[model samples]
Target: MRPSASVAALLLALIVPAAALAQAAPCDGGSVFEDRNGNGRRDAGEPGLQGQRVSDGERIVVSDAQGRYRLPLRDNRSQFLIKPAGYRLANRASGLPDYWLNVRLQAGPALKYGGMPVATSCRDYGLIPERRKAAGDLDVLVFADPQTKTATDVDYYRRDIVEPLLADRLAGRRVADLGLSLGDITHDDLSLYPKLNAVTASLEVPWLHAPGNHDLDFDATRDEDSLLSFRHVYGPDTFAWEEAQANFVVLDDVVYQPGSKADYIGGLRPDQFAFLESYLAGVSRQRLLVLAMHIPLFDAAPGRETFRRADRERLFGLLKDFPNLLVLSGHSHTQRHVFHDAASGWQGAKPLHEYNVGAACGAFWSGVKDAQGIPDTTMSDGTPNGYARLSVRADAGYGLRWFPARQSDSDKVANPYLRLYLPKVLRRGSYPSRGVFANVYMGREDSRVEYRLDDGDWKPMRRVEQPDPAVLAENARDDETERLRGYDRAATATPSAHLWNAPLPTDAAAGEHKVEVRVFDPWQGEQRMSASYRLLDTAQD
Candidate 1:
């Protein structure tokens, strides 16, 4: 909802002086007032929300007893409310939660596409009553790279990805009370914001967003203006919110330098580092800190630094005091888990866990189409296009389960967690160098994976840092195909971090046999999943 004239005038008065002062002057904002009528205005009888947390995407401040807050803005900042438990944000015109206010005061060169206007005052977020929740047992849905570039891709997202999640996440009871979209929300198309917002609104939860490289404004000439459209729509590019026992920080780690077109780099800006330092100082060391960003904190592609190392080391230093921490990112379109300890620049008691989540619109909606007319956009790492369900316990422990996109109406795999690939025809005693492969989508480096052929004893599988053959074959098909109809081709297959291989047992009987593969999750010990594949014997045939 747009602000009323009176509200806008009040905000203007609060902002004009700050803008008139030194550009770097500490810009502060208005109060967190209660909207008695659900309107985005301060009507009579409505009082301020006192002692609530407010931030300028950097340092946080608490509202006084009068519900007034002052933010020390350093750049093009967006003010956001750390929505206290039991309070939910009022819906905006585009159906996004009204938890953020764009307070863009500094201006840059005008572009073909518009940028944020001068701000006088930051808007106050209106809240309604909600079932108060703690930082306890909570389920949150995480979608990486829902990078819809066109209306059709958006349609595929709604049909293939959103529908199933809506049913699964909303079924029986709403265990998933929160959702997070790990950026690339669109593929450089700012116009698609409304469409993306509309579909995601169906999830029926206040969703948080982090900006990706693709979300940058190509026309902007400076880094600060790169996310003008994004910030205008999704509020702060970086902000923090508190859950029961966790502090969730969504950061805009994609730094864009505009020229012919915006070139992007992955790393936190100086202000982000300063903000994190200040924010971390007040946070309890025991609380779980989950930092979600569009780009990963570590380089995934070989010989290429996806994220800057110095920035990561600085971030690690700030996080040293926090024993319980998790980093999440979603730009590689591949699924893997990375742990950082002292050796990796983290000086924490336990290694920091970061889930480089798979993309929702896997491989940018490429590859062949399914019967449902949706692209079979499997990731280059062989992980299916899916979302993550994260369960954070009251004790600060967490579990993440990868949910693959529903294949088709007739799909009936009892254990659909892992993908097992077996040899089509193996000679009775011939051992192939690479036997069978199991792409445990959520598998970690230390995960216990075992396989048994037919009724033989379960033998452990070796964790191999290699690309999944299935994805390699899929990539080959795109390269070999005569005609491809998608907007883009699938990404080249990269070495998967969660894959396991086992040589074929040379002593197996010459007949049809089943290969059962099991994965015992390392972090989540209770989660044990299995999938089976049919193996054929060439000798018998």
Candidate 2:
């Protein structure tokens, strides 16, 4: 029907304001409904989960009896159901862990690299009923930086890493309880997200993923939009869940900014800090606090700040109230245990332990192929490409053990718990610049490492910071090999954090001698390992 201009002006005034109000409607919080049938979706009969806390990365609110809650959201954000002690969020058919919902009022500009495909409004979560177990005393497998770049690399991860973990049932522990991927789950190739999820699903466990620098959306113009794809795939980048008698806080510490190219720095967003402080305020100080992220909270090397000091200091301040704390990170492919205490600005009474675990994609899947066609991706720190098993006690005490990618019957018997390195050949009774080296993979500062010469008395091995000779040799092999050995050579060898050295015994005759090394790990079980060293009387030669 046609209308006069005066009548049309009145209609426009009425309709325009109504439409704008609808657009501004609140959706900051959503329902956490119960899916009794385990279908992973909210159906008609499903009831709402009440009294649970949900956060939108800034403020937290408790779900009412009807399971409805509201958050103060000013813009696009993610809201997650902090899996309470007695419940768990449902898993997706895509195999990716799903716990949160993205709340977007409207779509942003179309990105050159394609940001989130569509804006989501109602962020509802569905969960299957399950009784919560005390996660206080549990074993968890942590895989750092699988970083599968290509589809082929995904296959490599499936066959080489996932298959073994499944075959072993994560070293005979419960796989469904807890497992974590420190970060860098994919190598920039977001398409492989499904493949990685499928591989992780085989463990049949609840896995938490933290987004790394490579997981950011490169085309996003602002730092806040950098993780659109990641959130789209893995839910909230900053969320906390309590289980295993501890609080597991997963954060997206990678800050991406576009420059001549896309560059990233390690720091936490201001909002995330506020979210952390708010969430922790309600948490009991008795529980163990485990902070899991991609980039470490402190620098890996001296004078080189891998993380922002101001942000780290801020985080440290927030953690001051918690006495039981542990930090787990995986960015550097190498593995080492770092202690953050007063010297590092950590205000906790006890020094905080940060485990910079090794990568599952050792050396980025580099090195020569083996009989199974798997690349021998030994880490630059001389730690083999593998994973770690964290043993958490009900009281929050914990210990860690590193598992090499490959293990054989002989290896299981010889050095099942440690690694010993020694020179293959040495001149008898002559000046030896480099001596026997032992890489007690799990040794710490207070560890006792001693060596004995073929039934001789045990002698202590001095701890030294140096590049592992074996790792150096592995790199040299790729460099000197005439044939192409791998997609890329191992990263230039770096000084290992746990290396012990001792001078070869000159009393031994010019013959083949076995140098046996025994180590007493402060945390792991005792280990005994040996390697044969040849002494050639240079004068006779």
User: Among these predicted structures, which one has the highest TM-score?
Assistant: 2
lDDT of 2: 0.79
Residue-by-residue lDDT tens digits, candidate 1, 1-541? 9999989968977867755454544544578877767777777888988888888766688888878887655456787888765566777888777887676556745754466666646556666655565545777889999998889889989998888767745666463678899999999887888898999898777789998888888887678788888888898988888766677889999988655343787888887887787777777656578899988887765577677888888888888778788888999889888887675577778788999999999889987786778888888888888888888887778888887886422356633457877666656566555478988888888888898777679899999988898888777877887887455776678888889998876565566667777778654453334434333555453
Taking all chains together, each candidate's TM-score versus the true structure is: 0.87, 0.89
lDDT of 2 by residue, 240-326 (tens): 988756789998999886783438878999899989889989987777888999998878678987788999999999998788898
Tell me the spans in candidate 2 whose CA falls farther than 4 Å from its real position: 1-24, 42-47, 72-74, 132-136, 168-173, 260-262, 408-416, 536-541
Off by over 4 Å in 1: 1-20, 24-29, 34-43, 71-75, 105-108, 132-136, 168-172, 259-262, 301-303, 407-414, 431-434, 478-490, 523-541
lDDT of 1: 0.78
